[model samples]
Target: MHPVCEVPAPGESLAEVGGVNVHAGPAIDGRDRRRLERLCRYVARPPVAQERLELTPERQRLVYRFKHAWRDGTHAVVLHPHDLIAHFDYRKSKLGMAGR
Candidate 1:
């Protein structure tokens, strides 16, 4: 089965995990729903961010780095886990469709 969310590119692995249900769209199964819930809980943990990098101070840009979550030399773009969850969850859906 195809994922509800679009496959992420290199340097965007976090979104890959967080966007799973979103990409899976209408095809999401019970297992996927459960996994998404677990993932949302996991990301709620306080110790998730192992480091922080300033991408651009002028633009107030920063990225939280999760060392355990990334492979060596690969970039993992960070977005708020809740935001990802909301994007995929029905709670934030206006028309009850997955929010891309």
Candidate 2:
């Protein structure tokens, strides 16, 4: 987690009830492979999507939008430039198996 990372509960988008996020949203459907794949995709997605993040006109602040709005109607967030990069995630394989 970033120093200022405050990811909201995913309840707004996936849960039947608004704002009720639990640790694990399970998907165990043996009959529907497609549905099960969709469920897994959400948890596997990166915390931030490139298109979802942008800098202000002056390039001072960072604005990030959620793919789906929260139940309370909040759709985006604003942050300082440094904060945006503080916890940015990247991958580099030391075992030489990354691009193979």
Q: State which candidate has the highest lDDT.
A: 2
Worst 10 residues of 1 by lDDT: 11-20
Q: Supply candidate 1's per-residue lDDT for 46.
A: 62
Cα RMSD, each candidate:
13.0, 12.8
- For model 1, the stretches where C-alpha displacement exceeds 4 angstroms are 1-44, 47-55, 69-72, 78-100
What does candidate 2 score on TM? 0.40
* TM-score between candidate 1 and the true structure: 0.23
- Please, what is the whole-model Cα lDDT of each candidate in the order they appear? 0.49, 0.64
List model 1 lDDT by residue over 6-99, tens digit each. 4566433222333334332323356787877876776586633444543445544445554556555656564555544455475435544454
Residue pairs in collision within model 1: 3-23, 3-24, 4-22, 4-23, 4-24, 4-25, 5-22, 5-23, 5-24
Query: What are the models' TM-scores?
Result: 0.23, 0.40
Distance (Å) between predicted and true CA of 95, model 1? 17
